[model samples]
Target: MATLSEIETWLHDRLPALLAEYEVPGAAVGVSFGGEVIDHAAGVLSKATGVEATADSVFQIGSITKVWTTTLVMQLVDEGKVELDAPLRDYLTEFVLADDAAAAEITVRQLLSHTSGFEGDIFNETGKGDDAVEKYLATLAEVTQLFPPGEMFSYNNAAFTVLGRLIEVLRDKPFDACLREYLFTPLGLKHAATDPYEAILHRAAVGHIRPTPEAEPVPAPVWALNRSMAAAGAMLAMQPRDLLAFAQLHLDSGKAADGTQVLSAASVEAMQEPQVKVPALGLMGDSWGLGWELFDWAGTKVIGHDGGTIGQGAFLRVVPEHGLAVTLLTNGGDLIDLYRTVVGHVVKELAGLELPALPTPPAAPVQVEVDRFLGTYSCEVADVTIRQDEDGKVWLDQTPKGIFAELGAKPEPVELVGRDEQSLIALKPENGFHSPHVFLGDDGTGRALYIHSGRAMRRAPA
Candidate 1:
């Protein structure tokens, strides 16, 4: 095995190349092995000031916070304070779904596993504070089911808020306090907390977004959660090393380095057990366990989660069989794309192991009469021009910049995948120029609409 010093030097040398290629401003990374932390640092903390990142800089860790919340709930389960299978309404009387009977069927286990069918996110349109959370829970009566409870997988944030509410009811304390008492304090995670109201001016990494090609990267406003939505993604301001400590605790079966039991071994195992099948995301196979993702990398079961906020991206990966963990926290929007590469490189360097290569998407087939797919198409979001190349492959020329040629010679129809209700396909090509084109109408003469982040557009005259 490579020495920790060797691994750190390798990362320090390669990480700068990645940041420049991906346009990320700064990152904090930590690695743990054999129940000990081997590496920690802040890299390129600020782009504008050239300030160096340090080991203690705090970054928003988006959905990775879900793991902590779920672990806390499982502790309650182990203590018999809460039953995983029992319907949530048993503890939270305020829990009312659009369908009262359906809402009554949702369980704590279902909520953590994301099978509750509750709508994904309900950011307190009413603003932050205890009243907002209370009002949102009161309005659950209007939240309808997307699928029957536990019958399918749907990543529902509202369900997690309900779990947070349950914690409040059982402990007679706010969710943040409960987390501190049960999880953070037990593990000695001093910098981790869910309370966004606390002053965090210093030791925090500013969130940044790479909005356009020409524009300088912009810092996103510091996002604070209204007390109501804290459970969903509100936990903030953690050093990458602190996050790694949490991962090590879990990898060690919830035992702190001092031998204190932070969580039961069984609870940690349960959190990594796959409860639902996830459709593929690129080279990554999908499966959801408790609040973590379970996937195989080179036949070793690697479990972890990725988090995204306004201007931050964070990732945690653990290989239990090898007793290794890698965590990366970045103050940029593009951190999502860096997870696989960073973790894979660390694993190879430290353990001399290679991750399984992403399966090759099938090649596009031979084409004939590609003209019907050509010409400009427009939708409510943006315009896309489909043109046939000399090689007979179809290319989508998208507006605002970038081009996405069809993947393979034979273009596969875009299909809906997973419970998250996102559309994807094997071999789909996307780039700066290509917009996420949705084929509308029959006969292939329909407009293409950008799904989430494009301005509205109308079809130009033929």
Candidate 2:
């Protein structure tokens, strides 16, 4: 491992040039190692404003807020106010989904670990009122089950939003207030913002997005998503330093900097214990804990999570064995690559670790039958179709819908290459990396049930 001075020096020398090389609008990076924290920033916050980014500039942490939401829920466990494995309906009686039986059986742990099995990508705008999360719960009544409760692993945004509602009921406050009271104040985080209303007070970095895949990124039309899904990571912005402070709390096992016991030590240990093994998706963890993504780097247990929203991306990686954690927040431009470079550099330098190898198209491949995967899979954001052309080349056609369309998402096609009997890798990179689409389960008919690209997109009935 490198000395903190050596790593800090390397960051000061390389961050600016790397931003230019990657065409990123701006970025903030922070590291917590050996009980100390250090951070650096570079580039313009917005090309439209031409404001330079500072180390204290706040950027949206996106879905990384899940870890925060998880913390709030775990606090309830510490107080004996909630049971982890108890059915969610016991707490929120109004909780109902398309499958009443599955809804009745869903437990608090299922939502925490994302094994509740219902469709999770539904990001309904339930209004900006305090009832947003409560109303959002009502919206899930129509959401279909992707699988039975506790059946398998799926990345679930709705699950956390539902958990957010649970927090509101348990704490007698709105989700934002719970965050501010339970986390921000407890940890003494000064730079953290829960919503756009508060984010405006800081030197906040706006997200950037490319209207078309071929163009340079521009300031996104909006700064954050609707507040209804805030608990599911719609709006939470903070400087890299404040973010590291939160990570430090976990390293100290729920103890804050002032030696305050904000979270219980048992809950902290439970959150890092593996709960479910995810599909063999290279982009995420091999398995998920209560809220954290558990990464197996060679044989070491690395805990972390990644978040993306409105062209902004945030990454948090923690090597608990070395008492280390690192985070990178970026507005736009090849974020996956930048994260790989920046956090990858941090992990390698501070912990003597390397990022896991992601799958890519094989150089030489034998074509296989594609008829089994030839169908349309539907989700809230997009409708993806798997089809083969007359030339016998299989490709995925993705057409944006709902919220994705509102953000100007476009339809595009990417060739698919055989990875194995049950999985395929995109022949071309979209955004910054290729998606390894894994097909699994039975849809009651003899076809592929779900096509998982991070989130499980269930196939529409034939």
Q: Which regions of candidate 2 are displaced past 4 Å?
A: none
Instruction: Looking at model 2, report the run of 10 residues with the lowest lDDT sum.
Output: 364-373
lDDT of 2 by residue, 1-462 (tens): 798888889899999998888889999989988878889999989999999998999999988889999999999999998999999999999998999999999999999999999988887988989999998888888889988899888889999999999999999999999999989998999999988889889999989998888889999998888888899899899999899999889999899999999998899999999999988878799999998999999998899899888978899988889899999999999888888888888889888899888788778754655777889999877889999899988889998887888888885688898988888888888766878999987776668888987788899876
Question: lDDT tens digits, residues 49-153, model 1?
Answer: 666767777777887888888988888887889888898878888888778778888888889988776555555444555555556788667755545688656
Q: Which portions of model 1 show Cα errors greater than 4 Å?
A: 42-51, 130-132, 196-201, 213-216, 283-285, 356-362, 365-462
Instruction: Give lDDT per model, in order.
Output: 0.65, 0.89
Task: Please give each candidate's TM-score.
Answer: 0.78, 0.98
Best by lDDT: 2
Error of 1 at 175 (Å): 0.9
Residue 3 accuracy (lDDT) in model 2 = 83
TM-score of candidate 2 versus the correct structure, residues matched by position: 0.98
